[model samples]
Target: MTLDPNTLLAILAMAAATVLTRVSGLVLIHFVTIGANQKRALEAIPPAVLMAVIAPTALVTGPAETLAALATALAAMRLPLLAAVATGVLVVAVGRAVIRV
Candidate 1:
């Protein structure tokens, strides 16, 4: 099969977008001043962003997933990372199983 020029350009565009996205955060951080609240917010942002992204899906899918997410958050606060992850997965699995009954 012959490679088309438009396809090549599209691939390059996607690669550039990906590269810029990954580096933009690091680049922007150099300009920011960190204080105690800023430090805490930065630490919290990843999980907050993740849940924000997932929240609509959970809401659309219904209560079981949302409750499981709540359980996971509670478990995460008191447990080790790995254990918290396991707890989340287990809660989701068990909630799903029970919901189907």
Candidate 2:
């Protein structure tokens, strides 16, 4: 498969935009003074972003996904991050296979 000139340009443009946003974040961060609240907000941002992406899908899909998310959250509190993720994935896969939902 080959990309034509327009498609190639579009891909490059998107990549440049993505890089700009990331680099700008780093640059802008240097100007900001992070106090306790700001630090907490920064830490919360990732999980909030993750939940924003996942919650809609899970809610719309069914109970299996919801349960899997709950399991992931609980496991994440204690297990290593990767293990927690694996546990969530495994639970969802098994639940889907057995429950047929």
Candidate 3:
């Protein structure tokens, strides 16, 4: 299979679309003055977006994996964010090792 001119053009169009959608937020945010309630809503959005992304994956994982994730989140709460991620990864790795033995 080869990427011909038509295929290349399609790819370029898709890339442009994606870039525009992402940048649209920055453009709007720069020009628009959001009110107090809107600002609060915007602040809340990140956590809600994070939960939306994580909640499904967490629910689908096995019990041990879920426990490991919880441990990681708790650890993260106590330490820096990166440290928390590392702790969670370590927990999952150790849990898997113990299970396999």
The top-ranked prediction according to TM-score is 1
> Which candidate number would show the highest lDDT if scored against the true structure?
2
Error of 2 at 90 (Å): 3.6
lDDT of 2 by residue, 1-101 (tens): 87799999999999999999999999998998889998998899999999899889987887778878989988999999999999999988887877864
Instruction: Give the per-residue lDDT digits (tens) of candidate 1, residues 3-96.
Output: 9999999999999999999899889989988999989988999988988997788767756787777787789889998888788788888888
- Please, what are the lDDT tens digits per residue for candidate 3 over residues 1-101? 87799989999999999999999988888999889999999898986798688867876877557767788768966898889888888888887887763
Worst 10 residues of 3 by lDDT: 59-68
Once superposed on the true structure, which residue ranges of model 1 sit more than 4 Å away at CA?
A: 24-32
What is the RMSD, in Å, between candidate 2 and the native fold over all Cα? 2.9
- Please rank every candidate by TM-score, starting with the best: 1, 2, 3
TM-score, per-candidate, Cα-based? 0.71, 0.70, 0.68
Please say which candidate is ahead in lDDT: 2 or 3.
2
